[model samples]
Target chain A: EIVEAIAGALGEGPLKGRRILVTSGPTHEPIDPVRYIANRSSGAQGTAIGAALAALGAEVIFVTGPADVPPPEGVQVVRVESAREMEAAVQAALPVDAGVFAAAVADWRVAQASDRKLKKTREGLPVFELAENPDILAGVSQMGEGRPGLVVGFAAETDDVIPHATAKRARKGCDWIVANDVSPATGIMGGTENAVVLITGEGAESWPRMGKADVARALAARIAAELETS
Target chain B: EIVEAIAGALGEGPLKGRRILVTSGPTHEPIDPVRYIANRSSGAQGTAIGAALAALGAEVIFVTGPADVPPPEGVQVVRVESAREMEAAVQAALPVDAGVFAAAVADWRVAQASDRKLKKTREGLPVFELAENPDILAGVSQMGEGRPGLVVGFAAETDDVIPHATAKRARKGCDWIVANDVSPATGIMGGTENAVVLITGEGAESWPRMGKADVARALAARIAAELETS
Candidate 1:
């Protein structure tokens, strides 16, 4: 009781009783022991969100892929490797007030990963088969038993950020789409900073670029406020 | 020539000829020598965007306020403290292909900051005077000379994310707006992950929550793809 009082005194924690599920980082699609397909994601954003949510007093379940960054404190973290693993983890953590799909899951994965590292042959580079991964956000949004009240997805595009994001939202059937231009020049991959657009079925809102931590805090606060009304 | 060959061998850089401008972090409004008004911002999203843009081969100029995280590599980074300083820095680095306003500029600043640390007596608390700060994103978007081709803004809201974001886009006179809930309970303020909605004059797109780095990469890639066609 004393601890709770101290916490309440420190900040006006709005999320006193809420469950939030978040995912982060990149999933590696392995071709062999030495080679894999993956994106440059540091998981900084997801970890920060988890921390921010905890600070606001919500019970957080953070599902993450292999990331170079550490997970935030005060949150229950479930670590996974592949998209399949992440999806399962998310499903297990569901029936929450809100769900945020933050991981950079690979669109395609190797059909079969060799147990041993493959070496270059005299003929040429080896060919490998690929398969599409399940859209975790879509699956969660459409879940029959444990669907979250709010489901959000990420639309990382190279061109036509808004248009593509809009299309993705419809196709994926998610409630919100956070769009960004991820040209290599932006240095967003594997970096700490970010700039983004938040789009919903109703319209769009843009924010000035700022630190991920600040963004997370602002987002957490907004979620708490909305949850209160909803 | 050899160096060029090696670089080409690595990959076909998409943003080689492009220019990008990104703003990041929270602006501090000073109250006294020992106090200032600021928000919770780490500048992760903005820095990640700047890095992502640079990775795609665009020359990126990053203007940021104080941040807890480090800026991305291979980009020109200009650090500032207050909103006024951030605005000046952004203005000096204009005429880019794209502009992303991700900084959380203080809506108000101390009208008069005491030169020395405020001394407290046996009396009550001290009162502060505040004034509005310049809207850097709107300023750059409306700049007559050396204006960026595309202007993006971010709207952080605790309620009516879509409506507020849409209004912000129109009021700010920017091409796009990213809206997200930033209520304290969501853990979005100081966290690493983000979930946002993209708002534009046409419509809105919802996205899943993801790492800030992935969001940055996606945004950068989309920007590159657009530039390629445009």
Candidate 2:
């Protein structure tokens, strides 16, 4: 009874009953048995977000592609390789309070992923017939009933970040869009620091450059506050 | 002088005065400022090989892509992202006694990689014009007078391992081809264990399943012996 009183005073750190889903890393679209098409996402920011959310007492389900960094310790990690697998994993981890789609999902995959190694030939360049990958963010955001209350998607752009992110937020039907420039000059693609703009229905707010962990903590706090109000 | 004599007695592991170059990981070919094409190579085997050669007193120049595993200690690490960068790095590390091409270099790159982010829309699928990438292994093997004394390449095959590897060895003009089956059933791709077949001018010799480190040690020993005789 005394412990319960202290717990009540602590107030569960704001998100004790919340369940969050986060997708991280670069999805590999198979070209052949041994070859794949991927992106340059390291999953650093997403993993940090998962950690931050867990720290706030949210039960986080992390659906991750093959990432350079290991998944956060506290989150339930669902490892996947390709965009299709990641989509499946994300769908399976649904019915959460919030969803953060941070994964750099490949836009396309080989129409028929080769079952064997593709041999180099003297003929000419090989033409890869590609098929579009499913838009997981849109799917989750537009869910009829199981949609998360808060849906966040990422737009990694190099030019006109704000405008593009705003458009992406509307197109993906997500509640918020975190946009960041990953130009070579910015060194944000695989770097530790991030400079991002948070876009919502209200407006756009740009944050100064900070460590990935800091951005993640801020985002987690914002989510907590929003959930509290809702 | 006495310590030098003792070292001589211990044989210096046969690669004492040799310089070796190794390539590892999956090269990322950019599609846009933020998107790229890559593979699933973790560079575990290549890193282990670098470590093994270093342990044998060989000067190892380790050229790598954005790999999951950190480069091994006691070696010169050259970090790169795309196949072109990797090829340039390999060329810069020339005049080595041996060259090991183990990287899963992207076979093609976007003909004109966009300078900005590519927008997604309701219009249609975006078409990417891809150009063939330089065959690093074949180029190094057929380097004529500037080529290393011993050149090795890798053939990650799923079916018909021996025939395909032998053909690859002949086609690439490499002295040896280390072939492995990366079929999903094998659980070798990105896994800690490996089962490889060494194809030389003599014949093919398949090794049993073992840890990647053990495979590296065995390969290093074979390289040492070949260098010693040559």
Candidate 3:
């Protein structure tokens, strides 16, 4: 353990001298004091990606929401619960060589979140006025300075994976977009295996179904190679 | 590990000959094919409760939703994603010695969930027609023939914890209600520690702030005693 720590401190591997930022899990946007809006993100893929990067000797900053899986070992973990918090955490861990936006951030938050728990009354249902959350991927990709050289975003789709992801790559202005089908038929959501298509400025490349850990390793290697070339 | 397994099979402890069903985590309600509505429940307390019950030699069937922490060891785990599925799972595990409903089930689901991803358009925001979900706790508690001897429900409240929980006990027809304040100021939501007020027909008892594991063990012990007497 001591030897490994010393080696890590010396920064000695394929991704040595490089800093990468990764986001994982589902953010919880407050609805009331006890209630929140969230999604079904286990953070398995993101945790694997962070671990893979670290294994390659990259200094990884893992900004995570409430995740089922624990953050990978040997990475700086910053926990946040809301999209706004995740954005702030990402901003704080800026100036990286690459950034991976893997979190399933909620798109909207209650416009007027109640400080107290809303009681169920005889009156009609409580109306939740929602406001759009900030676009972290677009924000980072369009940054004028201190932006990562490679900005990768994820799009979990049920259909038209390629077309939608291609359009998303252009819309979000990210260098790469990892798209996957998450329909109930796929059993991808909260499942161990993943089948993704990598969309980039060059074109779209479909990868066969693989374990999330394998995907992470391959993606990390690709990131290293891209950084070396750029 | 082998010896522990043998002991578990023998059921030679306080809760021997008992079957306990526990529900944990937050149920996800689909809005669109790629989008969902969920609550902020990590299932930490419920996971610990399952572990504690198992430790007391109770055969535990854990019905879980998408949870942050992994399901406890020494229990049968049944995974579900939505409130409807959870209710079905619970009903299937009926005729148990006790039932613990710890899941933060979504109160509402979209009336018509989209078959495909809802695209962002220039027209207007997509309105989600919401419908109330079935009351799982009430349904289980009102099961006259097959209802467990002891039925416990959880109420995550921000204010008026005691009052609300006391009322909830009657409304749900449950034997006990474990209530806690999840206000941001309280730091209980997604946190490891808990301070709960256990409400019963007898009265409400406030417990000191403690680790979730400790609370689970205490609650499990209480359940064992109640079952033994009943």
lDDT of each: 0.75, 0.88, 0.88
The DockQ value obtained for model 1 is 0.01
Candidate 2 error regions (>4 Å): A1-11, B1-11
For residue A28, give model 2's deviation from the true position in Å. Answer: 1.5
Which wins on lDDT, candidate 1 or candidate 3? 3
For model 3, which pairs clash? none
Candidates arranged by TM-score, highest first: 2, 3, 1
DockQ of 2: 0.65
- Candidate 2 positional error at B74, Å: 1.6
**Tens digit of per-residue lDDT, candidate 3, span B86-114:** 98999899889999999998887778988
**How far does residue A175 in candidate 3 sit from its true spot (Å)?**
2.8
Docking category of candidate 2: medium
Q: Is candidate 1 or candidate 2 better by DockQ?
A: 2
- iRMSD values, candidates in order: 27.2, 1.7, 2.1
Candidate 3 displacement at residue B53 in angstroms = 4.2
